[model samples]
Target: MPRIGVLIDNNTLDDHLAREHGLSLVILLDSGDRWLWDTGQSGIFFDNARAMGIDLAQLSGLALSHGHYDHTGGLDRLWRETDFTGPIYGHPAVMTGRYACSCCSPPRAIGLRTVNRQRLASQLIPVSDTARLGPGLTMVTNITRQAGNFEPIQGFYLDPLGRTTDTIPDDTALVLETGYGPVLILGCCHSGLENTCDHIAVNLGINRFHALIGGLHLKSAKPNHIEETLQTITRFGFSEVYAGHCTGTHAISSLSDALPGKIHPMGSGLLLTFPPSGHSTT
Candidate 1:
């Protein structure tokens, strides 16, 4: 069996826990393998983890989904606090400068901090292709763009001046082979969920996904874009979906209306358990 715990998120299960505009997940496998996926925008992850009684030093590995500051900001704190010496998996571009400029706000640095990059230099494992973490877990890198309708956010740039377009190629997902099917653990889904699913189907021969947990990065999407994304998600037929972080309230509501009980609102302190093969819930 495998269990997932929401260590940090934009919302909290209760008022006592602190909330943040970021995401982080802790995965515990039946074999005692523990993996930390992404670290939230600040030390809030550690705060929430302490409240939840999760020990950061027990992590067997660390994985970053993209270069966004919201995803990798806690790296400095993690390094300073935890004694875990495991490899940190991510794309090479994750440490590069990234910015976001919208009509509403000025260009802001949204990439990983240099200090954290230096701290994680020795343990960083840049994966250009699919990298196997364990027997049933794999890190997907450089997801190909297969869905033409899905577009990256318009205001992102690779340069501080917001001149060079940032495709966010480093956005990745972790796939876990479960008894039911493949479960996708995403950071922000900047490459588009449809594209990520297609890449997995084509490269890994996985057609159905049992569950999808993490941000979709659709907070500022247009109505048509949201509709198209929802339609594509419906076509894939995921059994369970816990979406939050960059997934706006409107989109989450729409998904809940469309999928009924299949959709769940993800937040800090939430936990999900999946039993091993042939193990009944009863």
Candidate 2:
């Protein structure tokens, strides 16, 4: 059996667990290798991991989903708290400057924050294209925008001056093939879910996805927008969507109404297990 522990997220299943406006998953494979997918906006993820009985020190590796501060903020804690010396996988543009701008306001820095740049750079493994991490596990990046991916990744800039739009080329996802079926894991999902799924289908030749686990970046979207996203995602055959973090309550409600028994809200301290039978949450 494979296990996925929600180290931290926008909410916590219990009051004892810490909550944050970010996402992090502790992936434990059947082969006994432990992998970390993203690291919330602070060291709180580390504390939550310990509370959830996860051993981060023996991690096989760490894969970043994007360059956002919410995704990479806990990285400094990784170097300071754990003895983990494994390679960090992400796009080469993960270190590039990123900013968030608004009407009549300055662009705020929202990229990766670190304590030791040299050490982090030394352990970085940039993924310009799709790559397999282990048996039945793959990291996908550089999503194609064709096939009517209208979900806009707006309000972001490549520089503080907002001269150029930041398309977030570093946005990536992970695909894991389990005994039950394929699971697609995301972080923020700035590339748009439809585009990411389309890219996977075209490049990997894997048409349908069984599960979708992570943020949809639809926290502030209107009801109609969430409905449209759900309509497009159904094409991928996802039975369960563990939406969390940036996926707002309104979106969850819309998902529940649209998919009935298929919607699952993610929070810190929640554990998702995949046995030969299927997937379950606890």
Candidate 3:
């Protein structure tokens, strides 16, 4: 198993810590294998990485959890700053036109960040089903719907315009396999946490996961959804859970109470080491 390190660079919180938009994560694997899960909204990315001591230029590639601005905003800086010749991964819709809606109101076409899009195509290695990133490293492509009361991720709406239809399927995630066990990483998890877990379990043909890092997409989850999610997670029996991003504070607290020590706080500059022996100063 290899060591996995994650940095939550962007978020939905405002200046006073209020929810608004979202972002992605920067995950680093052992053997100097590095990846950007999602770039984040823009201004804060590079600085955030520096503050966290993450060198994006050294990253092997950049991955988009989805096509939202908050997730892809940092691509411009990355393309401008580094000679990084690594592949970026994501669904094709990430480059296509999309929209953001408000209370089922008129659709506001999501403004395309052309520069970033171009950089992604030139640099990205778009994946659909599944692909081996590096040794023992794989990205999941199967999307499934499990029988349970847990609600899927919500509030994401697409518009059915001229050539575009409401297509949010571009939402995806990343999974890393370590020496200890497989660690599931997510961006927004617009798919579903259970789906993500189940897919990984089936694809890898292994049930036990050492840890689950990244967003569980529980911020908007209903009570039943939360309860079912917790139950499902308990069944998987992950040793540690480092979650945040789209996961609300209230939900995190509740999960913390339910699981006690198993829950770990995830933020912009947090590092988690594997084998339970690597020293983490932060």
Candidate 4:
């Protein structure tokens, strides 16, 4: 069986849980593949890993879903503190400035501060399409929005002055080809969860996701958007979903109703397991 650990997120339930101001995940593949999905904004990678009992030296690789500070904030610490020597995966745009719209104007530069930028460059691999991180595990690099009704979540806007762009396409996910099915792990899914899954299906040349983990970015979804997402999930036939981080209570409830016990809430210290060939029994 493969093990997955939540290294960082927005909320921790107890001494056994950790909730911070950002999101990060540690993925353990059945093939002995290990990775740090996203790093939180605290930049306390060592402390967090020790607290969670995750040995940083054991990681096979490090991947960033995007360049957002919340997603890549620990880069400097990881590079400066740990002995981890691995390629960091993400789109090239991660190196560019990011911004959000404000007051109906072009937007403001919301990219990570200058110091962090230099550190990220030192560790970036900038993958495309699919990068096989290890046996049976591939990173889906491009996520597209095919549904017309699926709008980019609000509060995200690009600066027209050329200072910075949303550059969210840089956001990505991970796919593990376990015995049960392709276990999909995402960062923010800022590019849209459906889009990410669709890319995975096409890239891996298979349908039927065994597990869905990570942020769905449905915090401010509209009625139509929610309905569309529900319909899409039903059509896609995901067996299980563990969603959180920017996902609202209403959205979680809706997904729970649609997916029943298959729907679960993920937070810091929450541990999910999956047999090498099937869904996790416990």
The best candidate by lDDT is 2
Cα lDDT of all candidates, in order?
Answer: 0.83, 0.84, 0.64, 0.72
Superposed by TM-score, candidate 1 places the C-alpha of residue 126 at a distance from the truth, in angstroms, of: 0.8
Per-residue CA lDDT of model 4 for 68-134, tens digit only, reads 7777777767766775567777887776666676666765665654365555677678887778877
lDDT of 3 at 207: 72
Task: State residue 122's C-alpha deviation in candidate 1, in Å.
Answer: 1.6
What is candidate 3's local distance difference test score?
0.64
Residue 214 in candidate 4 has what lDDT? 81
Better of 2 and 3 by TM-score: 2
RMSD of each: 3.1, 3.2, 4.8, 3.7
Off by over 4 Å in 4: 104-109, 113-116, 147-153, 160-167, 277-282
TM-score of 1: 0.94
Better of 1 and 3 by TM-score: 1
Error of 4 at 26 (Å): 0.6
lDDT by residue for model 1 (1-282), tens: 888889989998868787898889988877788888989998688888888888888888898998888888888888788855789998988887889987778889888854845658788999998887755778998899864667555789987677899999998999887778677898989888888888888888777778899998788787777887787677777989999999889889888897899888789999888765432111
- Candidate 2 global CA lDDT score: 0.84
Q: Give the Å shift of residue 215 in candidate 1.
A: 0.6
TM-scores, all models, native as reference = 0.94, 0.94, 0.83, 0.87
TM accuracy, model 4 = 0.87
Residue range with the least summed lDDT across 10 consecutive positions in model 1: 273-282
C-alpha lDDT (0 to 100) for residue 71 of candidate 4: 75
lDDT per residue (tens digit) for residues 1-282 in model 2:
777889999988979999988889988887787899988999799999998889899998999999889999999898889856899999999889889998978779999888777787999999988877755678998888764464556889998988899988889999887766788999988887878888888888877878888998887776666766797668888888899988888878888888988888689998988864233210
Clashing pairs in 2: none
**Between the candidate structures 1 and 4, which one is better when assessed by TM-score?**
1
